[model samples]
Target: MPEYIHGGDVYSHAERYGSLPLDLSANINPFGIPERVRQAMHAAVEDCTRYPDPFCRAARQAIGRAEGVPPDWLYCGNGAADVLDRLAAVLHPQNALLTAPTFAEYERTLAGASITFHTLREEEDFALTERLLADLTPEREAVYLCNPNNPTGRTIAPALLDEIVRRCAQNGTWLIVDECFGDFLTDSAQHTLRAQLGTNPRLILLRAYTKMYAVPGVRFGWCMTSNTALIEALYRAGQPWNVSVIAQACAAAAAEETDFARQTALRIAAERQRLRQELSVRGMAVCAGEANFLLFRAQDTALDRKLAAHGVLIRSCANYRGLGAGWYRTAVKTGADSERLLQAIDEIREDG
Candidate 1:
């Protein structure tokens, strides 16, 4: 069997441990899919027999309008993972640089292309600095950056990201920023590099609908780049009907639901703050995560084992590249779920 990377491996573990618990491993929206989105999916059910639009024309247009980028500049995929794989196939860089303890998929995709990859250590709470960029090899072909990065939930400052983009462009290196969790940030537009897409031909911005709309099953995501040529290349490499008919309609509807998006942002902000305060009171060393999750270092491995035993699963980051034992990540769920998780952690602390 393949090595299990993160949480949600409950099925394999469930065989040994019995029924799976509430999965907090994946950084998904705790609110789940909205009622409007579910209704849209039911309405789209009749279109299943017809093949989904190869271009995802309506969906792409909606996303383009919402994001202020032209439809031609966007390339939709099964998920951001699909876009990353296609990117690897087309770019096939000989060397890539990524932050250690960031998203695992970037490394996994790079490995599949037989590329040499290096990681920048996350000393100082996984923060990125100008000095880190200075260490990149002149021969390096590309760099993968995850904003409000996974596991650690640390975001690169806007000024720093601008400097990195400028430096990468000057060095003739491709800079792919995976902002899948960017939506979780309060001022997403301020930190996002989307507006600078046309300024730097070497930049590729990846965005996803999974976490924001709570529709991972739909597998909708897109890559934004000013390089029309690169966008065309990715489009050609993508499989036809990569996104299902229902998914396309659902994605289109979700993109247009501005009110829903606003409400989600507010709810997440409040819940995240509440979770942070509660965890702090419990004495867990929590990181000030900007995303919809809080990353904390448990006092010991006993906390992780105890939480799982209570049927409340959270990500244990021991498997990540640079993280060690005691690292755990949990999503900001509904108020009730949050309370349940807090209760579970309290129990663990009491027992320990």
Candidate 2:
């Protein structure tokens, strides 16, 4: 059987162990769902009898104010993955460029295209350098980048990113940068390409409230681009009721929680540092990442299963491209949860 590409298998863990695991597998918000967002979702239940707004007007307006983009430049989808499906349907790219070990959803969306994986070297700590520019040729029609990438969790350097955008624009390659996890960063502005978005209509910036708001089940994500033509096409291509009423309400309410977002970022930064220090002190090869999660390597063993015995779960990166056994990704959760995961690993190491 094919392995699960993503994480958060609490259901399976419970089925096996007869209880839920401390699921750090999915890199969701450590604080869990916000009360305001929860209330919004609950309140939205009454609106379910009515069909959702096909255009998601109110939600987009709130998102626009939070993201500093005109709602016209934004297009909502069920989730980032659903938006990606729309992208795949719209842009029939025969040749694509993607980095190794980035988000798996990109490859799934860009399937059937001749994909060139620019492998991020482990020696260089999986950083996307200027060398990727060499692959942004005229033949490559599509490119996807995960800022503070999924498992590695490292944001690409700003200058290198700008050069990539320029190269893609020059080659007329469609560029999609997944900044879903950007909100977890303390200075997400520094790493984002939002400044150049006005000049580059072909550049698609995807963001989601799933991670930061801890509403993965809510399925709220949107993409921003200056290309009005592309926007219309994506909207028309997607279902008229692409985003549910609950999701729209969550998006709008979550956008208004600026103070909540700020506090989460500060909390994540502290926990991430603590996790890094603890992992390194335990002799793990922790990557240099500034996101709400850390990817590290331990001595090759059944760490996932071992941790599971202790009712803990972490994302195993064996299936991710350019990575193999012994590599794992764990979310920087709250102090208690983080402590449980570390304690489990320490016990396992000592047992050996």
Q: Model 2, residue 62: displacement in angstroms?
A: 0.7
lDDT by residue for model 2 (1-352), tens: 6666798879889999999999899988878788999999999999999999999999999999988889999999998999999988998788988899888988988778899999998899988888887888898898999998988998999989989999889988899999999998898889988878899988999999999999988898999999989999998785799899999999999989868877898998998898899999999999988898889998955898899889999988888999999999998889999899989988998898
- Candidate 1's TM-score reads 0.93
Clashing pairs in 1: none
After superposition, the stretches of candidate 2 with alpha carbons farther than 4 Å from their true spots are 1-3
Per-residue alpha-carbon lDDT of model 1 for 4-61, expressed as tens digits?
7866666855876888787787778876787778898999999998998998899889
- Top candidate, metric TM-score: 2
lDDT of 1 at 298: 71
List of clashing residue pairs for candidate 2: none
Best by lDDT: 2
